[model samples]
Target: MRLSTNQVFNSHVSSYNKGYAELSKTHQQLTTGVRIQTPADDPVGSARLLQLEQQANLLGQYKANMTDATNSLTQEESILKSMINVAQRARDLAGHAGNGAYNDHNRQAIAAELKQIENELFGLMNSKNASGEYWFSGSQSGIQPYVRNADGTYSYQGDHSQQYLQVATGTQISISDNGFDAFESAKNVSRTETRLDTAGPNGQRLYLSQGTVATQRDFDGGFRAGAPYRLEISGDAATGNISYEVYDKNNVLVPAQDGGVGSYDPTLENPKISFLGVEFTLDAMLKDGESESDYATLLDGHSFEIGMAPDRFATVGSSASAQITDSTVVDADAYAAGFPAGGVTLTYDGAAYQAFAQPGNAPIPSTFDGVSNTLTVAGVEFSFSGAPVAGDQFSISADSQENQNILNTIAQLRQALEQPADGIEGGNLRIREAIATALGNIDSGMMQIESTQAHIGARLNSIDTLTLENESLSVYNASTQSLIRDTDIAEATSRLVLQQTKLEAAQAAFMRVSQLSLFDRM
Candidate 1:
């Protein structure tokens, strides 16, 4: 068909423009080194590339999380190692202190060193990470874990919650542990104590011997059940005869092994009193020229408690001045009757400190003697030295006679070393008992630290494993992404040359053909 001049020109121009466009695309691909410049270039490959890119970004984030987790766990492991070493040193000091040849002065020197060690342990327990967050504070990262209360007792202020980091799909690692489990929950070997209020009629002194667990199984059962026993003396010393009655926390009398009342002779030395798979002796501290009558009067009407100790106590409100002096669960039945499962909350209304059961906020029968600064409630007697304002609160709860903190153990040992012995024999006995208890608790604390270290080591191992897995997946993703999104350098270069030649040929042909048009030829 014969074409008009304008139609022929339009056709040649269109051909040239198409060739140039192809050439320009090839050159852009070569320059950018990407096959799919837009989704229109290769729809399927572009979509796949997008997915691969997302996976690569996710892998990078996982890698970063693994790094942070590793660093945190490493710091914890190192701190725990240091704590173990310090505990070991303290144990050695305690073992040495138990030597019979060591005098009160020598024991005091050992205790001073122990106090330094205790300070070291305290710092370690409250250690902070590079971000200034407490390592053992669990989810409460910003709060300090261990704090010394005003009553000279150490308490764990952190909750038992753990923090985790996601390192991979379906894989989360714990990055922190609560301080309560690690530092504050050592097993208490000495679970019995003479009542702090036990005194003679004239306020003469008497101390109970450190009790022994005669039967492990029986004691363990009772301790786990929170079974508390009380011993009361009734007979007089005039006839050189003294009888004692054992009662459960409910105030019911317990029969002796021979199905009779237990008797003790004050004239005899260190008479052993046995009950509930445990045995201890009542030692009367007879003063110079003091008679047995005074000892009998001291022993009468006073009670000793077994298998009970304070577990956890805290004072609330900024102005609460009621420091807990004695929180031992003296009367278990009374404690259970007054305090509920959530413990008791004592609030001072300026006139008296009212007791209320926790969680439910039920009021409990309680009395606070303002003159003596003592609050008696739920079979627990709390002595305070400072005046408390209205709305001041205090909370205390007892454990199942199971655990004590490492700091308290060390503190007790230190106190024993510092205090003057009741007498030569009494002082030695007290020091020996303190040393034994300290050694047992320190060992228990060390074991707990080691367990935490092991857990950290396990988490680190998991991180290493996950890291390797993530790296492998990342490599695979990179390879797939390169195949789908990266340009073939050699192929793009050859295509660019061919497209350039085509564009030039199209322009040459179009120019020649346009010249041959009828108008141009005429």
Candidate 2:
């Protein structure tokens, strides 16, 4: 409280320093466009700014993810579109080749074009992304999706699991689809069929029909359903001592129902070999050698596979037609002899169902289950259309999954076209069937490719939506951050002028007070 000149001068000096500091801070805020140059300038605002910056960074990252995902999806869609085009071309070729008038040379030429299309499709399926990773490889993007094996068949090496990118909060989008689902698993309609691959005794081979030899009933049986199994039948035709051996897909011998080597009883009316819910009767005819031992020896190592045969349905009647609806076997021999007007009845004797023909009952009325698309008569599934009063008849034959892929379809067509017309008993008929099946598979492949492309398009849409959302969020974050930490230029300029005036006044007062001190006046 003492009115000393020295004290007054020192107080003025302190006030001037404070005013100068305030002016400098205001100038810094106006020049830099930020209210808080350091945390001490505005601790709470600085904390808020830090939070807003973190949020903005997160949103930016989300936007980046969306961009990457969009790129991948777009690439996938383009590749799939190309593949669809290739498939469509192949389908057209198949359609042209299927014409009955086309000669073997014509078919072979078409097949050559189809082969090229197949290779192109294979390339598309193994397409790479911007990062050079396979687009359809699923989670294994680094590995190629498909590889050609030594046998000329393509194998899908990619896993089924899909990979996703986090494009938004709690949102993920798949960027790729598994090649298997896109290329291999596309089926328009699932039909049961068997294909025969007989080894040894060329002349003894049953002019094996071009349809399913076995149907898939229960996939959860002891034996694997999708995979192939070998059925080896060997024994003396004279003594009828034929025994059958069964092997699984891995070549491991599969035990019979009794867990022993499956035995075939010759005494049974139909000498059938049944395993894993599939049953097919052996041909009762003897070989050319004609000896019991020779028949047995020649039949040695004669093996055929039993598996889920597909695309092997045949309708035999011009009017009332029959198609296979279930996995049950239709004895081609029996159905042909007694079908249409023959009146076949299914006899279920508590344990199992059997097909029996009522001799007098011609044009038998089949019990049709429309829901399952099945008609049961004597343990065979015949899907019939239109009402058969008494004499209407039709029949379908065996089928399998062989030649299901585009490559295999083309291969079968080429083989059929290249083979001599008079080679086999039904050579022309078999070639016709092969061409028809190839065309059907190509159509199905086209459908699958289209579906996959549609899926990719949807993903691209989602990514665009996410990207817009991220941009909006980023803008919001920037505005909030500015509100918390950016300077108001008008307010800062006003404060700077005021602070400059205060500092000038304080300095003038300090100078006057210092002059008034006793030592200065002396």
Candidate 3:
């Protein structure tokens, strides 16, 4: 079979070209250090590599977020530590200012120092971060958190919304705390007062000791604001026996324990009365030359109110002027749980009174008794003394728990120290009370700051944990990606040498075959 010279030349050229192409491909793989340079080389492995790359990018972003969060939280913790030290100093000054031996000049010196501390605290509370954003400004990082008011009081302008940073997949951490919660919203020390609502015929006065809470949980659950318990006295002057009936804020009779009746023996010294987690002593201040027996008869219609002072109580509308006879809290738990933070408002439309929560004007379930002139709602009772016309409104506001800001506490202490106590009515007593309140409030503020610091610490720990996990995951991802996309250096190098040898043989054979042909054979 005769073969053409063109066919022999074409066959050798094709073999040489195929061998060179194989050798070039192996060399390219070795240079790039990747097994599959394009999707056509390994389609499934290329797709998997793309997924791993995207995951790695996401992990990198998460690490960046974690770092930022850590920095922000660390800054906050440092500021809070400084603020706590300032609060401790202020508390010490308050204790010193309360000394009765200290004269006006000494008090003035303390006041000056307190003013400086107040300013320092103010600056610390409004501290800025590395990015020039306020640390305690909630989500409004650009805005200042606390601002001084015209009346020397400090106001929190920032909102209560917290800022969060995503530290990992399906994980987020709070990076900022609001000023209101950290500085202005500490609980105040609980206290109660007793006042004579109605005097007896003989102008006799009922004396009551400061009411004290025996059980905090019970008190928080049972006590009511604006609602005072009523104490009525009834006795026979002849027998010199006095019996009392206690009524709660809801006007419901408080039954005696062990089925016993509430009785007061005037013969004994100042007797103690206990009810609803509160305990206080009761006594009578008689007129001149009057005996206990004579005062007992006059006390039949006398009544006294005992409860916490209301933050706000006012009657609105011009047509009808009604006085609040009694404002008492009966269900403290209900009020705390259901009452709006903004407060509540009651309006009378001539027939019945309607209760509405503040801010959004949401309706609250309330019942009004026309015969008793009482409105009961949110575990509190409001009693009116006069007739009301349509459009008459009554507003009663009291926080479920009282709070005083650290700045206000400092301002009050400074004012007390600066005021002259000489020859003023109850001036010394007022200063003492102010100092005591300041001390308590400062402690509360310190607690709040410490709590925030702890929360910041917790977030930092979480960031650390997430960082380690992210690192581990990154290592795993790198190993998997290497397996799928990286070249096996030893195997590729050997394959490249073999392809080179084969290409050399193909070239040599092609040269000899091209030279042969029919002319060489002749």
Candidate 4:
């Protein structure tokens, strides 16, 4: 088709402009080494490159997390070793206290040392890692695990939540032990006194059984002498110097105040009875079987025995010869296991008990079902043997594993040598064993930490390897993208030179063509 003059000129101009534009773009790429300067340059290549950059950033973050986990685990392991040392020290102190040759003064000095140990242990329990996190407070990384009260007894501030280290893929390791399981709760016993009026004018007397003088109680709801307590009993001087008694916790008689009678009086000078309603076992008493009621002849038979409260667990005696059956009575652990949710309705057979909790419905029951018979309470766990009854009640208060059994023999020997009574023979064997168990736990914890370290190290190593491989892959991918979308510097330079020559020729031709009017030619 024949074209108009304007159309022909515009077409030639478009061709030259297209050639110059391509040449300009090539020159710019040669000036800048990078293939893609912005998204507009090559949309697909730029997106892929951005993705590679994000992956690199993510790899860096993973490395940082690995470092934090490793450091925290290391701190936990160090603390466990320190705890092992403390257990050995405690065994030594117990041995010193047990020495028969030691008098009260000497014992007091030993006790002071024991006190120091307690404080140190408290400090250890409250130990903070480099991150200002608590050592044994479980998941409560910010709070101290134990608090000292004015009453010399320590209160546990930590629960059973075990903190864990996230060192690897799908693997978590416990870094802390609950403090409650480490220390034993002491049993508190006390006494109170009140006048016993003869039951219904029948001259009622408390029934006494043989070898029962050590029973502790609060008489007529008079007063309780348990933990963090003091004894204060009031009496009338009129009842002809009323007879009373005193005792201690655990049904053991306090030697200083045995068969205690008040030495104070309401009106009578120095006529005070310090011991009123003292807990005593119903030992042998003058017998009348059953009695008759006559004020004159009624007081004649005068058979009496001490009454006991149900709350006060009774043991026959502390004598090792008293048979192991009575052992459960003073054993706080046994009571804790056997007692109900409110209080233990101990078996009359006097056998040790294992309390359990009832299964809840659906998910709750499934948690402890036979197929999945694991009870995980903050990582502290126990398995139930049989299905729980409706009223089944597991103990919330139970002796925790102290892990002292892992102590080295050499450390134990040192303790035995320094304080002879702490050795593992004869009556003191139990105490020694307890300390050993704690040490054993330390060993176990250390092994766990070391194992975790290995895992974390492996994971970190993997991260590094994978991250490096990914980096290499990213480089290769980038090179391929550059090939598809990048300008060739050598080819671009050659085109730029050729385009400049053509552009100058086109300019001359255009100038010549514009001057080609008929008048100009004439």
**Candidate 2: C-alpha lDDT:** 0.62
- TM-scores for all candidates: the values are 0.77, 0.60, 0.70, 0.44
Candidate 3 residue lDDT tens string, 34-142: 8898899899999999999999999999999999898888878888899988889999999898776898899999999999999999999899987898988889989
lDDT of 1 at 109: 92
User: Which pairs, if any, clash in model 3?
Assistant: 224-329, 226-327, 226-328, 227-327, 227-328, 227-329, 228-328
Per-residue CA lDDT of model 4 for 415-457, tens digit only, reads 3334444322222332233233323333343444345345445
For candidate 1, write residues 1-522 as lDDT tens digits.
977888987887788788888888888888888889889999999888888888899999999999989888888888889988888998999999877677778888998998998899889889998789998887998999887766566767778889998899888999888898787666666766655345456553555666755565766665335446666676475765667777676766766662125877656644566666666656666677778776656566666665455444544334545455655556768876665766778788878888888778889888788888888877877777676788887766554446777887888788888777635756755775677678877877788788888888889988988988999999999999988888899999988888888888878877787666356667
**Candidates in descending lDDT order:** 3, 1, 2, 4
The runs of at least 3 residues in candidate 2 whose Cα sits more than 4 Å from the true structure, single-residue gaps closed, are: 1-9, 188-190, 194-405, 517-522
Model 1: colliding residue pairs: none
Clashes (backbone N, CA, C under 3 Å), per candidate, total: 0, 20, 7, 34
Task: Report residue 181 deviation for candidate 3 (angstroms).
Answer: 2.7
TM-score of 1: 0.77
Clashes of 4: 34
Candidate 1 segments whose C-alpha is farther than 4 A from its true place: 192-324, 328-331, 337-343, 356-365, 369-373, 385-400, 422-425, 517-522
Best by TM-score: 1
Alpha carbon lDDT of each predicted model: 0.75, 0.62, 0.76, 0.43
Evaluate model 4: give its TM-score. 0.44
Please give, for residues 31-104, the per-residue lDDT of candidate 2 as tens digits.
88988899998888888888888888778888888888877777778777787777777777767866767776
**Per-prediction CA RMSD (Å):** 6.5, 21.2, 8.6, 21.0
